[model samples]
Target: MADVKVAVKILSELKSFVMQVASQEVVLDCFRRSNRDFTRNRKLPFDRLVLLIAKLCKKTLSIELEQFFKELGLENGCSVSAFTQQRIKLKASFFHWWNQVLWQSYYHYSGESTKRWKGLRVIAVDGSNISLLNTPALTKHFGGQSNSHGNFTQAKTFYYYDVLNELVLYPRIEPYRYGEVQMAYEGISQLSADMLVIYDRYFCSYKMFALHLWAEQPIPFIIRGNENQRMVKEFITSGKRSEIVQLAPTCPAIASLKKSGFIITPKTLLEVRLIRVELEKTVEVLVTNLTEANGYSDDQFKELYFLRWGVETNISVQKNIMQLESFSGLTVESVEQDFYATVFMANLHSVLIKDAQSTVNQLSKHKKYPMKVNRNKSFGKLKTSLVSLFIEHQPEQILLILHGHFIRDTLPVRKNRTFARIRKNKPGRSKHRTYSNYKPAC
Candidate 1:
């Protein structure tokens, strides 16, 4: 993780940033706020938490956690006492706080939720299957998927949608071939009132739907149209070949309606709006309890329902782009520890990216405090860019850093990015231009 750490120039700024973010007072208060003492047997100081995070950043990579704890005995030329071993395990509680804090921060930045057709907040639910274990021992802890080669290995998680913010919440994680849907069912009991939950076709079942109604939750639902399901068809195209049609409910449970009411089940009549769209040479059918007169167009409802893609993209970033599957750790505890840590890091970076951009945007608008252009020079795989920037003359500076090489660039409040155009006639032109600048978001 140290390889991913901030450089000295950026570190100073990052320290100030972290202080604001994970300040000691905030950390302690948050820990105490949880109203639980993690280490009741022995007490330990806060520096241990700092060391754990620093080590995660790979600042002191070679030493094992305990060895490092022992090494910390000599930190600042003073010996830390014997009781710090319990500190290591207890410190993880603080990370839980950090996670919650960051989630709240990201939540604010994400956006606010909006209601679907009849003012029910819409939520899209889905899952991502992850390979948590391949080793034999790990398989005992986190089971695997089944296959011809071996029983396939993975953890599938059901994620509840907070679409406006593009964040997934209430994840129900379990092994493949069993338990995911069950866990999701148990977790769904916590859903808020008046929410419209859209489900993948696979989750459609009479038993689950029955549980929802029994709870008296009063939350409407939308799911894909299963071909085998029976329903009363309302408004069919008079002679149109397409099998799709818009409808209001005429179910047995909705007898009072005789035909006009809002009901999710066949018993209670529901006024519904259905849409079938052709995509990729395939017909896709959707069922909704919302009607056309509800002030939300079918097009708008469908567009909002499509927000599930964001969660899939998030999983892609975590497992594919972030190289999580490359993890070589074997223990289940360590793997989960690493997973939570990575989640925290990803959340932190997301917050930082937005924060940095917001800061630059606000300051850049002011005339007296123009943001500077920041040039990011990567050391490159073999440190070639660093060599050119450090050893070569000014002519090679642009050549070395150009062509897809990017470090985490930070733009100052005021700066320029004009490169020379063939040895300019004037010295000012040859040098950097104070007015012209690079991309601020770089």
Candidate 2:
């Protein structure tokens, strides 16, 4: 009951903030046109509600189908069957825009602002592939390649999210055959010059680097050590241990990165920094331009490269744990739409959990209470609360539930484990054919 009340409250809060940003008519029209929902005379929009439901269902359906329901307490109705059978499609752009909207809402509700690092928000770029339902339309479009399932092409997505801002980002998807580097290169157009783009070796391109340099913000790129033989020169020399120096060349890769310099267009140059670090098999000469003379020392450049970890973890949560692959779409377009929506939901939840924790921490100091907010509980509590309230249609009762309810650090459990997840679910024998009504997005 407490959980149900809280779910409703959070749903109400999401709805209220959504309305304040977009008109009800405009929002509904976008959904109707986008074909994300199945609505007939449905006055109020439940796009966020359904997305939250879908996320919960996807996150749990592979785990404990029964307990997933018990957690949400929707055994009698809104079962996994209902969620699947409904087959509501949200606009891919709706999720993209919602990503923007939620960031704004977080700013409004949480009353915390993210300051730009070095007068700019440093964002990073990377890509990962997720499995998708291989319906005829999907197979024809996203064509699965190979894995344990044998040649089901994964949906390759290019992502750009910021680590410092605590902001999650929406990924743009492309066909796997196109390659992640190609996908990442195309995604560079969406990035602004003001943003610092930290990337891996693959993204260091002559043409694309020049484009950011041309952009107003003078894009700064932090790419990894080059494997290309042409990029290698002698930075250090020893048997099996030779430090290679990358002299600044006429490469367009860091054009935007050197905007602070007097020369607007950096002559393609190789910058080398001497450092010792161990890789798996062997530790060889590493070369980076980050030096004591430049703003960054040998250590800071390595630290910047390490920022790459944030994107890796984000992709893991979205793919392995969040079950983002088990989305409710048969077509690649629909899958893309759901993919972004899931991202928005995750980011929104991140903000909520952060805020809840901050609130508890503040109160804890005053009350001398040891209570702190647990991430799982904070996320679970908000999500579970939204499911019940929206389904029950009692938006007004939200505040009462949150009143005086402290976000607890400890999640509820029965000696199972800390931050327990249900074991991997094995599918029962069922017809492999997709629903006949399924149609591809045009």
Candidate 3:
């Protein structure tokens, strides 16, 4: 099938990049013992360790070390201690670089322009909290939130999600005390002039707007405005659909900008456009740098603002489908490793499923209700076939197996579905159980 060939080509290209990274001396040095000779005793090479960790990330159930190695076809595999030691030495940057490589490769080969909106890649920004095991190191590094029930360790996760491509650009995990807006400010550095970033009202601040302008090549952004904010109130009172307003920097904003190497005075003001849209129940205000002269109209802004919901669904996929909260290790190092590994695995799945999705859409055309691939089933298949896809000499055969399994099951989409928001109380930490005993209904 055409889908099978596409999947094979994508995986082959990914494997080639992974091989190139593995051959780098800097990457190989990370796995070597400090005192060991670089030329000799290369027991667990960079590629093997990377494959091992990636396979672990894809599993639904926790796998022990010996069984994992045996599954990898290593009868005389290294000890569990050796793997752990090597994993510790493998810095988080390795996975970051790996993700960048895959993204660039996908961008080059996939001809993905259909996913873009009006010649712009729409990136959504948002933050969520990820629950972690209550260990001393985890609690110390990630911190926790306390309720009447008790305290549970949690980490703040920030995502720069590409809505059109179904890919995550930058995923950062920080201490629970770190504010979401602060993370958003730091994330601005990743943007380019061509990107159009969208944010929820929580990130609407003068400093955020200033940081975007301070970029080497400033990028465009759209952010929801808090209804109660003074600027929103003024804009609503003006009785205009859209307007460009000058915002004077606050003292704190000036200080923050100055510290970041921008010497701006408090009197300096930033000009941004404000657009108002009326919904069924209430009016929504959005702030953006997009202008009417650029062919960005008020009607277009309404639809573009709703695109932010894609990031919300993306987060749900990470938490509910990928089991991001169910960490495998108690240490902070292991937690970081699992976090980035899961992100990498998610992107890999996106790349593999890209071509198959079109085929799925075609198959659903005859049905009364349109359908899409059941992500749960596809992820399950990926978990079982991933190691073989990587290690087996004939990857085409494995890719075919994956394509056949993935396209078999599809779920109907219910259009215009709406549900009332439910606020559930947080259960106490006393109800927590070991991850091994817990099974998620995917």
Candidate 4:
């Protein structure tokens, strides 16, 4: 188990990094210029406003503006309209840079071995849709899904998740009409040779595969095969466990590569290995660049593919546990701010629980089943204590409180648990109005 003192030190480092960014001269100057009351004193400073937004993002329940400002110690709190104006003045880039800073600091402090898989960082790529409030601004910016009942606004979110570390390396939001494949291609630009990307069948295409291979470092990837594809069909018919096949680029793929400064001709064929695995009801095909000669065997591919499920669970945590679909504001800027802030808090929560989690695992070794920290409980405790960790003079007291609560409540891990998938249709709202004529029975 990791030492509590070490964990405290890491938290202190994170606090220092946040303070450095918030207190930068350039950042302060930018805020001063943005504020209408630059010459007059105000209750809400730039750093305070940023911290307040961060706390709101982590809060489990919706907080009214009056109560929120009262908790911040503003006796005569600013009005809702004034607060909205202040929030609009702040740029979303501030949160973006802060998240980047936090990510880089985490990588520096946390050892590389903690996040690496066989000397490579394993990353998974997937996209999900976040439901937004039915507002005209939201509909105009993010679009919406249509049904027979009505139209509901939604925003498409693409994530590049670190499967081993349980962290979102990058997240992008676009309109609902945006294609996942296009967003995925944009995500590929962030890859490096030291990383191994895993993808679902939806991302399996000639252009996608070629783009990765053509990178300067040539990122290694494993993508589930689409059975209808010609190469995949041929490999499956051959009944070979593994074989190398040549993929001919399409005209559009060739043009894309040429535009990206890669010299390729019509005769150029890219070599990729195809691995065939038989499951209970179907034969699964995987296309990857890793080879047997390089020490990657057929058995290892199954385990590697299973790791991709971590990203799916990560999305579940965001949507269900964090309540990511609940927006604090209706504007596009506010939506973007909330999105990045949620990601930052998620990463922060992971960092804070590392030591407690290790301790719990060690203590559970003699029990009937292995136990893990209850995430919902830990998140709640963290939310209650988040502001104190930053603003209080003695922050170690708050950290100790968080550590104690996190180690107390733990859930047992039940391995090999399976259940039939649930399929349910979306529920529609009732058309009848209840507010005008309804009365309480009492």
Better of 1 and 3 by lDDT: 3
- Quote model 3's TM-score: 0.90
Overall local distance difference test of candidate 4 = 0.76
Q: After superposition, how far is residue 239 of candidate 2 from its true place, in Å?
A: 13
- Residues 234-318 of candidate 2 have per-residue lDDT tens digits of 3223333324344453534354345424253454444334454445565433443334554654445445566767788677666
Candidate closest to the true structure, highest TM-score: 3
When superposed on Cα atoms, how far off is each prediction in RMSD? 14.9, 9.3, 3.3, 5.1
* Model 4: per-residue Cα lDDT over 90-167, one tens digit each: 776666666666666666666643668778989999999998888899999999789897898999988888888777
Enumerate clash totals for all models, in the order shown.
21, 32, 0, 0
RMSD of 3: 3.3
Go through the candidates in order and give each one's C-alpha lDDT.
0.45, 0.54, 0.77, 0.76
Roughly what TM-score does model 2 have, to 2 decimal places? Answer: 0.64
Off by over 4 Å in 3: 1-10, 30-44, 57-67, 76-79, 112-114, 423-442
Candidate order (TM-score): 3, 4, 2, 1
**Model 1, stretches more than 4 Å misplaced?**
1-98, 105-122, 194-196, 207-217, 227-273, 355-442
Q: Rank the candidates by lDDT, best first.
A: 3, 4, 2, 1
Give me the displacement of residue 280 in model 1, in angstroms: 4.2
Q: Look at candidate 3 and give me any clashing residue pairs.
A: none
Tally clashing residue pairs in candidate 4.
Answer: 0
Report the C-alpha lDDT of model 1 over 330-432, residue by residue, as the tens digit. 5554455445544554444343233334344555685565552232222121122222222223413333233223323444443334545764353342312
